[model samples]
Target: MSTTSVSISQKLTLSGSSSCNPRLAQAPWEFDAMPGYGPGSSEADPVPAHAPTNAEARPGQLPQLYRELPEEDLHERIRAAKEALGEDLVILGHFYQRDEIVQHADFLGDSFQLANAALTKPEARYIVFCGVHFMAETADILSSPEQSVILPNLAAGCSMADMADEDSVEAAWEEICEVYGVDPQNVTPDDDGKLPILPVTYMNSSAALKAFCGRHGGIVCTSSNAETVLEWAFERARRVLFFPDQHLGRNTAKAMGVPLEQMPMWNPRRPLGGNTAEDLQQAKVLLWHGFCSVHRRFSVAQIEKARSEHPGVKVIVHPESPMPVVDAADASGSTDAIRKFVAASSPGDVIAIGTEINMVNRLAAEYPDRTIFCLDPVICPCSTMYRIHPGYLAWVLEDLVQGRVNNQIVVPETVAAHARVALDRMLAAKPK
Candidate 1:
């Protein structure tokens, strides 16, 4: 029987967090455990024999005791459970996670980095990912079959991922196939050895999409390796169709000297995805109509403000931000790249970052010697990332200590088998 992919809890609400709010800014552990994003939404067939056998058994409420505990007690509880579990448990914290959650992380980095980190610890049976849904799903995909990946809070879902669902993309593919008068099922190469279009999905997408790419001879890409991934795709196909984040696709392709006119945004709502027949014929990259709300919030105005306020300020932005914001900054990269840029700077450098609030704040705390701050003066963490409160971490860990696997994220073998193919292609694209 097929179980839906990981539930989309954060999809229910944008986010109840605000950096401006004193309570939310503090260590507030209390939260609602919203569940399910419809059935059979973003996954595949039969459960993996090696995956958590009790896939049907998942987390429910946030346990009143966890919600009621003071910040110190909550942290102490997590530490105690972590100590009790020992090598059997490994906590992976996304860079966007709150400081409270980060403190308990055995491994800390971006999602792709964290997934690779899981492989380093073969002895750890439980991977508690203090990140969002897609991240936990990735850990499940890459980790040992005997291991289980868990998300502390079920509601921590990425809004950008939700933008490109499986069904809509399938529909788009069929339409594109009709335009090229080629079979969508099999992308045969021409005499020049280039296919009509090659699909390239951002790592932020659902596992179902990754499987789609694998089945159709496409590949996956993390933000850090988009350029390399694109180069790989171009070598195989005449053009590309990038999904779930138009900004990333646009910015990366633009840097590679792909003209703006040749990169058309695909709007699922319109016929031919809002492109004329000629646009599709001339298209080099068909960017999906999707984006990250947090990155999209950044604008050219914010960079200008930072420059005026801090003399000789060095600016850097994530490519997920709109093209204008990326253009205004001195450099554009993935989460890891942004961190490295700051690390390499002189101690006295005034660095203004355009990304999530929690990450920027964490960096500020890390490098007290440098003048580091977020470009957006208004405090707002990524709505979804903030869903992972410390309360949930304490609850899940304690439950694991009790021999109960709550919030277990299990990807079906059918899905993981195909998704891994696409993920492997991404790994191969890494710079040597």
Candidate 2:
């Protein structure tokens, strides 16, 4: 399939939730429970080994309590749960989460920052992550063995991260190795102290992929430091194979003067990624066929509309956006970076942002003096991120209050060891 076709299909899959509001999808604790029980329902159910127990709603039906509970009541319960747990619990919220959930966060930042934040609070027994599934896994990999990480909703998963599975990536690696005549078991360095190619994975990927990078002399990168990581890779390798985000790799490499002709998209299903041997040999960066659904919704037309309607409007977008959108914007960075850009602006400055709706709305509310709005006015949130509702937050925190560990995310020791190496390398890499 073409890149556009792939993006559309993934968008449909990512947004496929039973509830009209994705956030109302059944929580893991709701499943198999008695029908009359609500959010604080203590009634036990026989949880299946493979199925999620927190899921409360019947197939195609939304949870009654989550839908009916007043916002004030939810807040009160969440507060009571947190106060009961005290310092024993540390809630980390990503900027993309809804304001209701973020208001209860002990630490609010991007994924990489939150992972480091998890390490700082070693005293906390539970780390409740108000983010997607992969983020909870990263926390599990980084936190101490004694500390348990919890993702409020088990259904919360990243579409972009799911695009590049381990099997497909391994297959691609083998094909590239054959093309370059390099051995994974025993790689030989060139005269310039560089290997043939290095794998660089974005932090948005799975922990297994991070381990893959660690084993292959590769490193992990976040949007804020992608350029630095790529520079580090190029110094030690002839070319780089970046996974789980084609736009980021392409935009970052292009900014460093790497031409588009030298960056080939790798569709794992296609033979040799649909490239000739000569093309593969000449490539500077092999980009995996993946993209962020939320970021992909942004368009150059939105930028134009913002400019036309609001004169002197400053447009800022996430680097995960398409190249055209990023190029059109005045600035592009991570979610935190976009927040910083808006924060630094003068009062009365109109700013248009291209990112998740929850964050944009929160920023607009935070900086009332400045006119802030999302470029896509249709309210498109990261479907996975939105799965984390305040109701789920209350449920998990209350579980801790009851001296039970519910929905704890634990990365296997063997996988965690390798994943940590790549994460450490990312933390050590200095910005260019």
Candidate 3:
């Protein structure tokens, strides 16, 4: 709801920062940023006045100027980055990142997992986040202010994270309070309290959102730990109001055998609690109408098609997928879980995966003997992640090498304290 800043420790080693060190695995590829051709630093290739601009032009006349740039000296750059920065810089990669980038990551995991990984790295003065914007922001919030956090590309962001913003959250809170005569701040234990109006936000939200949950006596949850987190929330609250992605909340609750009729959809724009008698009285969970555009593209029909076309085709989907998509899949989990499954499965197994395109492509390459394809065979990527091209990563790393730090994400002080409240609650929750 409001912004605040937090101070971070400037230590550079991962040991002093986090309580534990994450075990990293070697990647199949390498990162190479050529010396002279850094992002936004190269001399623009000049267009000759005589060059033909149209496709109708003859091949020679069209553009002899289209020469490929030299490939980055992968090993050399990696050695340089490691040697120069040492513990001062920590590179974090999400499981969904391309293999090329993942190869260079000091830490690799899902969004919340990566943030948890970054928090323990107190030795690092700088964190170069390789995931979406919200993730980097989360790192900033969780870490000390002295430690700088940079997103390789300022443009990099997450669609699912963007679905709910400050205004929307405030508006919803206002309506809930107005209709129910319940203060979000005053909810507490009762001998027979109907259910606490507990707010469960996904990890894919802004730091401010997390802080809102924290200040309001709520907690945060990731895809892998949703069930346990929800169980924790339910014990304290009268009813759970899960935000951003309705699909994840619905799917997890359903698996727990909570009937579909008990979960109501919250409409912030509506009054009367934004619910019908059946929706409010019978509700166990209140799901928001947000979803990931990428995951939502996966359909039951696609899974059926994959099964029909190939025998033993296992369908694995992200929890953010639509209800039907998750229902049709053989299994569902977080990005890291999906990768682990593919890695552990026997060779020659056919798998249809529902997640971001880059991850699916990487899995297909890694497991050549096994058939792997996207559940939605469309040519779309996580638009925010698409912003983190090799060029962007190189530029940010280069900046850290210099005294300049561009696009540093900082979670404000007040917000960080409140957000920590929610995160602390989550950390205390036992696994189901």
- Report model 1's TM-score to 2 decimal places: 0.88
List candidate 3 stretches off by more than 4 Å: 1-79, 193-195, 272-274, 430-432
Q: Compute each candidate's TM-score over C-alphas.
A: 0.88, 0.86, 0.80
User: Which residue pairs show collisions in model 1?
Assistant: none
lDDT of 3 at 315: 90
**Judged by lDDT against the true structure, how good is candidate 1?**
0.79
* Best by the TM-score measure: 1
TM-score for candidate 3, please give it.
0.80
Q: Scored by CA lDDT, what does every candidate get? A: 0.79, 0.79, 0.69
Query: Which 10 successive residues of model 1 have the least lDDT summed?
Result: 1-10
What tens-digit string does per-residue lDDT give for candidate 1 at 121-175? 9999899998878888878988888898998877666667877888888999999
Query: Scored by Cα lDDT, where does model 2 land?
Result: 0.79
Residue 301 accuracy (lDDT) in model 3: 91
